[model samples]
Target: MDFLTITLPISGVAINPLLLVLLGVAVGVLGGFFGMGGAWMVTPALNIFGFPMPFAVGTDLCHMAGKSIISTRRHAKFGNVDVKLGLIMLSFDVVGIEIGARAVMLLERFGLAGLVIRWVYVVFLALIGSLIFYDFIKKRQMDKSGGDQSKSAITWHETLHKIKIPPMVNLPMAGVQCSLWLPATVGFMVGLLAGFLGIGGGLLMMPALVYLIGCPTYVAVGTDLFTIMLAGFYGAFTYGMKGRIELLAVVIMLAGAAPGAMIGTIATKYIRGYGIRLMFGATVVCAMVSVILKQMGQGGAASWVIMTAVTLMTAIVAIGMFKGAARELRERRLSHEPR
Candidate 1:
């Protein structure tokens, strides 16, 4: 293990090369599959493996820039990326992030930044996770009862669209015509939370896109990656300037992330929108649990818990991807068979 370890340039910490690779693979799969940076999962995992806590966000963001571009390009090939929506969201995110960062700075002056942020994180994660899980369960029950799930899923977005605020925008790619304020407001909120929490906003943005902006599941994933790519680059540059980023570590992680991203992007071709939502819900719940444990001051236990959840979620998604891909291949083969 000692010989397998290497020191990162900026962080100046020795870590196993293999662990970096594996972490990249895990987050890459999630990011590509779900259009998230997976920083929520990656941050704690890095801390557990002895990475400096302060440097974790910078390193993760640095890697996320590369990973998101790879994933976004792959998704674009599938016609799932909504470039217009992504750009719109990106602009608002910049504003929100600044506001949120400034707010955090103010809180720090009062000596309450850490505790306040942690509690808010716990609340946001728990609430959002529960809502997603509820939606998943509700859809399942509807399916069992032969009710219409699609109608139910879009009800919330539809209501928001009905607000009829001025400057409504038409998102042809996403198949939505609604107030521009909808996505702008959503992006700002996600950015604010991300800035305050010091993590990639993808985890928050995806749900908002799906439930608030009425983007198709696949489109939401791809567009989120588009936004994350730009944001990641900004985050990396700022953090790198502070000497918190390890370029070598980022390169090693990207080595594993590249392949994982390919697999994840390809998997989208076989999986349905609802299937993606369910998997995302599971991961959010995992994050929620980890936050709760952390708030309770179980630092050691929380790290392991996060690792377990991420490992399990990644493995399950990988299995699903392979199984779906295999089934598709078999179906194609059967269709091509002569009578």
Candidate 2:
């Protein structure tokens, strides 16, 4: 056990390298499947495991930039990415990141970084998780009642699409026709959270793209990952300049994350629509519970809870991918039979 421990040069923390790799793998899977950088889990997990909050934020961002490149590429092959929409969001996202980074710095100056950020995570995760479940339940009721099954129970995006402000954009890829300001506004807010929470904004951005921008679930997943890549890179640079990034940890994590990301992205091809939303809701709730445990002075329990949550979610995604791939193969075989 002691033999596996390595000291991080920058952070001066001696931790098992295996933990870093495990976190990377989990992030990779969840990021690809959920279209996030998995920072919401990683930051708290890292902090729970020993890193300072600032270092956790910086290292997570650095690793996210690399992992997202892999996920984004895979999603594009499936025609899930809305390049125009992602590009539009990137500009505002960067500005929001800068503002968020500054806010983090200010909080650090007052020695309230960890406390404030953890509480924020609890609140944000609760809101997002609740909304997802509520939507899922509502949709299920509609299905039972023989109502319109194609529409989401929550129709916020419908209202947003009607804004029709000047300089509208038509995104054929995402099947969205709305004002450019819509994504810009969403991007800025997501970026702000990304910077403040070190989450790369995927947690909120994915839902926003689906619920507010009216992109299909898969398109939202891909586009959110695209924004995450840009946000992660900018966030890493900003945190690196501040001397908060742990390069050694980032490299170690990426070793596991790269492959895990591919698995998660491929899984998305099999698990569509509400399936992703339901699992994502569960993941968020698990993460929120872990954060709450940490805030309750139960660091060891928090670490176990978060790690277990990631492992379970990763297993579910991997299993879905295997089953889907097998089904496709069987279908192909049947279709090509001597008929």
Candidate 3:
């Protein structure tokens, strides 16, 4: 495929057709499995493949909207989504995004904005991803020993839920009756980062929902997908109104991701909490590796072989997840009494 040029009133931007499809395929898998678009994968891929930074950001926002629609519709069908939480999150996301955008502009004046924003994104990704990784690891160890933690340890959600603040609101999906600040704070923080980086911030939101708000893994996947649905539409509309979006590319990506998302979302049903967390953590780790390679490439130490390595690593991770879930299902089937 050839790179297509989309001209805005200000300037024309070039987008690689092959890279867009590649991004759609990878994000579709991650999004369907965990309800996160892995826009952390999209934005960087766009930038590296030769789109101007602004266009890359804008176009990914458009693409994310379509993907989120497919994902949200699928997840919502599973009886896991919380509409109230999604609406509450929507209220502050706009405010956080605007303030976050202004902050980025201020950083840009000093020529340090891009570096600072990316470093911040990586830190958040690592911190949130590490927390999920730790929980899954702890649970795996306990399973091996036939022991379980009795909810007495300091989990981020447990700590936050313990605070006796006023105006406790209930989130059925999160299964918490804590202060409004808890949910709003988590959403606002992630929203701010998303606005600044032109990302969907599902990685940030999903973990915060699980650990910060005590949402179950499956439910958090649903809630996160629902909220991303709103953000994506708003983002794409804003960009499209400004004539900065490539609608053609977005349409093609959507055509693939829609059905892929349906299958990905269904796969979660056969998977356990630990299995989902393992895969989710593994996805972030793979995204991290992808980022590392892109960084090395920037430093002139990368090769096309690195992309192949990334693809292989990602495939192995997905297969490992699917196999783990299959084994669990098979064992459960074996343990059941015949009807």
Candidate 4:
């Protein structure tokens, strides 16, 4: 392993460069496809691979800043990004992050930070993953019965939008008209969770945008990336100032993440919105399992579980993307044939 190891300058720790690149690639796919930074996946994976918790969180955020830019550019080409919504959410999210960070600091003073954060992940991952999966099942059943599954009838989003409040705003791109406070509130809460957990916030924001703010799944993904870019920058700067960042490791990850994001973003054009939702739900469920394993003190087992699950999920998403693209190309060729 000596031949494969590289010493990180800031942290002065030896690590495998190959492992960093692979982690970046897997996370890049998840981020690009789901419009998330995948901190939930990356942080634990990093910890398993020898990064201290602070270093893992900091380096992940640093790479995410660049990875998100690549993915967001591709998503913008498809007109999937809602810039206004993203900006609004970013503003509220930043404030939430500060508050959440302070709260975590307070908990750390009492020696309860680790236990609290772990349980939070358990609760959040379980609740959100189950809801998304259930919705996927419901939609499938509705499709079989020839029932309508439009925005107006899709769970709590419709009900939330119906709330009569001051300062109503319309997001034509997201195809919703609701109070501006709606997104702000949701963004703040999600940001709080992200900051407290030292994550990128995408795991929570994707579902929030789709279910609470009533954005289309595709739009939710794109917008989430835009906001996550800002969050990453903030996280990177804060963690760097605290001397917790390993810049060299982050650079290695970015090398793979740049191209991986492009691949994942392009896949969006081939797959349907429902397909993205299903993948998102499945990945979250996997993350939940990984977090549970780690909480049990089975460090080696947890590491293997996360790496295996992430690799498998990324491969599945990649395959779905390729298959969908191939089918589209075939249809196009057929339509162009002499007839």
List the candidate 3 regions with Cα displacement exceeding 4 Å. Answer: 1-22, 46-53, 149-154, 289-339
Report the C-alpha lDDT of model 2 over 1-339, residue by residue, as the tens digit.
Answer: 999999999999899999988888888988999998887688878897799999988988889998999999999999999999999988888789789989999999999999999999899999999999999999999999999978888999899889989899999989988899999999888889877986567778888888888899999999889878887898899899999999999999999998899889999888869999999999889888988997899977977887788889999998998899999999999999998
TM-scores for all candidates? 0.94, 0.88, 0.80, 0.91
Model 2 residue 59 CA deviation in Å = 2.8
Please estimate how well model 1 matches the true structure, expressed as its whole-model Cα lDDT.
0.86
| lDDT (tens digit, per residue) of candidate 1 on 156-204 | 9988989888998999878999988988998889889988987678888
How many Å off is the CA of 114 in candidate 4? 2.2
Say which candidate scores most in lDDT. Answer: 2
Better of 1 and 3 by lDDT: 1
lDDT of 3: 0.70
Q: Rank the candidates by lDDT, best first.
A: 2, 1, 4, 3
lDDT (10s digit) by residue, model 3, range 40-69 = 656656667666766666777888877877
Worst 10-residue stretch by lDDT in candidate 3? 298-307
Question: What lDDT score is found at residue 280 in candidate 4?
Answer: 83
Which candidate, 1 or 3, would have the higher TM-score against the true structure? 1
State, as a TM-score between 0 and 1, how close model 4 is to the true structure. 0.91
Q: How many pairs of residues collide in model 2?
A: 0
